[model samples]
Target: FPRRRRRQAQAPLSPAMATPRRVPTILFASSVAAEQDETFVHSLGLNGLLELIAADASFAPYEQTLFAESALQYSRRMQTAEQNGKLDRRVEGFLNLLSAHFLSQAAQKALEYLLRHFRVHRHNSASLLRCILPYHGTRAFVRVAQLLRGSEQRGAWLRDGAGRLTAPPPRELVVGRAAKDTELLGQLTYLGAAHRVAASFSAVALLEIASRMRFTDAEAPLLRSLLEHAREGIASETAPDRRLVGMMLIT
Candidate 1:
């Protein structure tokens, strides 16, 4: 009779009641919010944040906010160089990184922001020019030209950096060496926006660019305009080397 005592049957585990399920909960909302603080976000680095937003559509809402904050932080870094004489390598590297990451419309905006807020020295301006020239082409050049037109410091930078600026003229001109030839006659029509900047800016360096200006059927009007500006600039320019000026006037 003792052996026959019925054992209580164990309740079968149902799917809903399986092994006391862990009730999912946000342990601390404040802790989660703290993780998203600006300091914390900035620590992620500009590249990291941009990559996260770019890679995940879910993060799209934060794109503009992140970019604005990044720019503000960048502005603080640039302020010192703006007040001081030169931009050190650290600032230059940061600008280069910024240009490298944002190469689209965003890049154009950033470039404009730089022109507006910061004092662009020769090195920094060259870095920016290099960034914009290859990718954005004439439009970008025009924007830079507009910014550099009136500023004496920037104009000087352009003049000094003219040789370095030669890289971005059009493909045809580069291939033909038209701008490099003795007469400077071929590939005239293919001149990019950088040439326009040279024309707008009246500096001794303009002579270097002016000398390379070739007359062509397509670019005849442009040549005429440049000639007018060059002639005007030559009048005001002290110690203008006639040799360089003469070459510019030849065409």
Candidate 2:
């Protein structure tokens, strides 16, 4: 009867005091666990942000090195599978995008370099001169025309204090319209024949050099004959039979 009474008394204490203690301890442990989880998630997000910054061009090499070191240090402390997976995906995507951007810039630079070489140095010629002539204004064209005319009359001039002075005399300076046309035709014929020869030689030279340079077919055609008379003048330089042979071979 005494043991039963003591057991009943202890049972009342257990229900009241022990239950409250267990409840508070469980709640405190849960609150601590939740705070730790929040901290871990926050740290993972911060690491991802840092990785994005490192992948950008604005970061210097030294700064990137420091960021990498810090990231490695922080990553070692990460314990959750979910946090690690999220971080890996974010880092991989950022790196892939960054690599593509750099590759695009490199490709653009290479293309520009090739174009500049082809335009400026490789294709410099009188045809290039003529193509650009229209852009130089009407006054520039007129000036060039006057210079060419003066060059034609150069034999009729004498060296004077003011350079060449007309020696044909004022009376002999007949402004014959027909004479002007004849002189212009002659000059044009000469210029055309000379340009034709030059162009043919240049084309043959280009083909030979291009072959040696291992240039693609796309590049060879860009070196087209811009002058019309170049081929005719080249043909006239050789004997008729030899010229025919060369022509057949070229075709």
Candidate 3:
């Protein structure tokens, strides 16, 4: 076979003509998030916010961060309303939303964020606590108690040694607490702290928590361990309702 001369090798392409290389696109972080779908868009603005909050909004553990932002926004709106002298339905919605977040992973963060408003609208903040205290159970009680007493135990976030919160304390909140209600609030606060520390929460502390806020027509349970320690201070009132109970507590 006749040997054929090999074709000359092609020279490497220059950068200008280098097969039009694709440039890598880099995305920089921005304070504003990229826009999402219309559903998301519809979920913004005062009306949208109210629509979402009209119902009890609950978030999963993973969605707690988003929950925190939403709750904060609602709180700010309430502050604006309070300033304007218009305590409206929006306020109540915020409370309901806040209560739902308590059960989320952001419970601690939610409380911390809540305490942030203590200084601004203290009465409302207290109302906020009063509303959530009844419905959220032990987790809520322990946190509010810790904040009230300024618990700085391990894992207690947003807490300092002084117990000075970003906001105020836990009484005179819901229902326009009268001077009569002071003792009950104190008892509740202690009960909550005791629960946080099992050693601190003795049989005596348990009895205090059992102190009924509302008086029931039904007979009280006896045998305080076979009729020994009697549960006292059961007040006859009402059962309730907030980031703060939904504006139902608005004074």
Return the top candidate by TM-score: 1
What TM-score would each prediction reach against the true structure?
0.30, 0.16, 0.28
lDDT of 2 by residue, 108-173 (tens): 222122112222112222222222122122332222212221223432222345655333222112
Ranking by lDDT: 1, 3, 2
Q: Tens digits of per-residue lDDT for model 1 on 26-78?
A: 12133343335445333334445456446444434444543346544554444
What lDDT does each candidate get? 0.40, 0.31, 0.33
lDDT winner between 2 and 3, please give it: 3
| Cα lDDT for residue 245, candidate 1 | 49
Locate the minimum summed-lDDT window of 10 residues in model 2: 169-178
**In model 2, how large is the Cα lDDT of residue 123?**
23
Q: Arrange candidates by TM-score, highest first: which order?
A: 1, 3, 2
Model 3: lDDT of residue 83: 50
Q: Per-residue lDDT for 73-184 in model 3, tens only? A: 4444456655534333333334445544444333433333334422212434444443345432354454454433212231132234674333322322311221134433
Between candidates 1 and 2, name the one with more favorable lDDT: 1
Provide the global lDDT of candidate 1 against the true structure.
0.40
TM-score-superior candidate, 1 or 3: 1
